[model samples]
Target: MTGDAEPASDERTPGRRRLARTVLTGAAALGAGLVSGPGPAPTATGSAGAASSDATRRRPAGPDTALRELAEGNRRWRTLHERHPDETSTVRRALLGGQHPFAVVLGCVDSRVPPELVFDQGLGDLLTVRSAGEVLDEAVLGSIAYGVLELDIPLVVVLGHQSCGAVSAAVHADLTGTELPAHMQYLVDRIRPAIDPKLRGDARVDAAITANVLLVRALLAAEPELAARIAAGRLAVVGARYELGTQWVHRIG
Candidate 1:
């Protein structure tokens, strides 16, 4: 992937155009801060499937700022006061040019943890990738690299949630020693390192969940491109836990 920064902007990006799930309407105000993307965007809920969306402002200046923005958003979400920052028509038209997302969030495929809604971000504001248990392989790595190396995003967040199906399945498979289905075995094997042989019940699942997030976060941080950026203090890799019980996002690493 090549950097999509325009001549006039210090940073910019045009993501893979994947459909993102929309939790709240009008939260796509992604153009106000700095990031840009082609919008009016589309949420994962259209007439046939995903719906169309307008963009909004609330651009974060850099990595630290981006993290802060996410934390505050999560607070709003936790308290049920989500401002739903950037989902307006003006925000939509503004991003017609490109995107300059401040952060790249690697989250789970769990529907409840949609990064945009969990962090209260909007259109063009985030470059997000999802996989069961937040697993990392070639394609996932490429997506993260594209956002960091090519798109100039300064932060990468590995977000794991409570009672993750992937993690729970992995734990169950490990305990029962039952082989999972063809494709699912791939995920089960990948999450093995995060399992705790001594733990059981919710504790076991939770342990693996956190372990998986840290594992992925470390993997991304150590990657050649991200490592160099980290060495230069230009990029940061973090791990976070999104709680379904209270709609809170906690920094784990």
Candidate 2:
């Protein structure tokens, strides 16, 4: 995994090219805010199958193994390395009917930051929910609840990344009182309360991002169904920050 932010269109198919272009063009409108600042964009190498296999191999045993697997995957990713696994026709055929994903990842909607690629997961390995800033809304929280209460996903990860534009916007709102677009403003509102008032200056954006992740984790852990599972030791909710410079996910509180 490389630390740089690559265009999301690079890995999509030709049939989806036009759609992707439209998506990229209207990213902000779609409420998928852009990434701020700059770093070397990481290039995705190897086939999806290979990546998935590596993810599967790292998976922990039982219904509650996602946290460890994710940690290991991030380690592999940080080194500009991958443990490519073969995605054979048999494997594809086997997954035709259903999927039993081990973990549910609630992440930012940034195109440069796709959870599957970052975690090196393959088809049917993860249940992913994405929204700007990883902010918790009724619908987003319900989706995560479904994964836990119904799908029985073992782990829930609130994944934030460095240089997140959504977070930066929230920080801006906190400091300068600048308002964001109407639709996107909700994200700021949801994340705003989580921002640490004591923290200030340029680095506040990064701090806000991590703060939001911690907030999401707390929210998930407190959710009724999720809370039950957690109390029973059947599930875990963890917060992580992905470094754009190293392509590694740093586990935070």
Candidate 3:
């Protein structure tokens, strides 16, 4: 269903309309932006799989490969054939000393969208950073830089999802002209620009969520160190969203 059904006559009241609009728009809204080409993933230097010399012992072969692997994993997850790879005792032991994750996943703090589970990644496969609505600051950017500059992670996936509470709250607050709690106000304020003020209800929230993903994608891609890596064909930064009902994830930007 498109979830665009008109409300009852009485439900068209301002408060009722606001409530209706606050509901999240699902995968129907596809966020848009530029998606950079993938780059080669750096070699794993740790002792775990380094000694075996098996390609599977390490992360995916390259940035493009990493993205492809995630897409395949999502297919498995949605199909109920999740490989759930690389969680064995030996794999855990190998990761004890250090981690050489293939990708850095920046996702919302929403429980349903855990990067590893949604992408079907194994232990040490992803460096995940989550904030309400995926908002970023100096610290978050610093962490991402560490993943790129230090760990040499080849892919950065900004994962948003359907019905984000944070985005919904921001949309509702914006439309109602109500300020949230201090810290929450900060988050809603950051999310405002991504949404159009003229839009109301679910359309507003859906648009904001997509905008948030693309905005974050551009922000990370423009980071000085990350920009260098992208220019050198050593990184790929992408924006994607997870469909709650379908268990599928697709790139939006």
Q: Candidate 1 at 230: error in angstroms?
A: 0.8
* TM-score, model 1 to reference: 0.77
| Candidates in descending TM-score order | 3, 1, 2
Candidate 1 least-lDDT 10 residues: 16-25
User: Which scores higher on TM-score, 1 or 2?
Assistant: 1
Tens-digit lDDT track for model 1 on 158-181? 899877999999999999998998
| lDDT (10s digit) by residue, model 2, range 150-245 | 877777778898788898888888678878877888988898866766666645666677777767777677677777776666777776777776
For model 1, what is the error of residue 21's alpha carbon versus the real structure, in angstroms, after optimal superposition? 36
RMSD (CA, angstroms), candidate 2: 12.4
Q: Quote each prediction's TM-score.
A: 0.77, 0.74, 0.78
Candidate that beats the other on TM-score, 2 or 3, i.e. the better one: 3
Provide the lDDT at 155 for model 1: 79
By summed lDDT, the worst window of 10 consecutive residues in model 3 runs over 11-20
* lDDT on C-alpha atoms for all candidate structures: 0.69, 0.65, 0.70
Pitting candidate 1 against candidate 2, the one with the higher lDDT is 1
- Positional deviation of 68 in candidate 1, in angstroms? 0.5
Best by the TM-score measure: 3
RMSD values, in order shown: 13.8, 12.4, 10.2
Q: Distance (Å) between predicted and true CA of 65, model 2?
A: 3.0
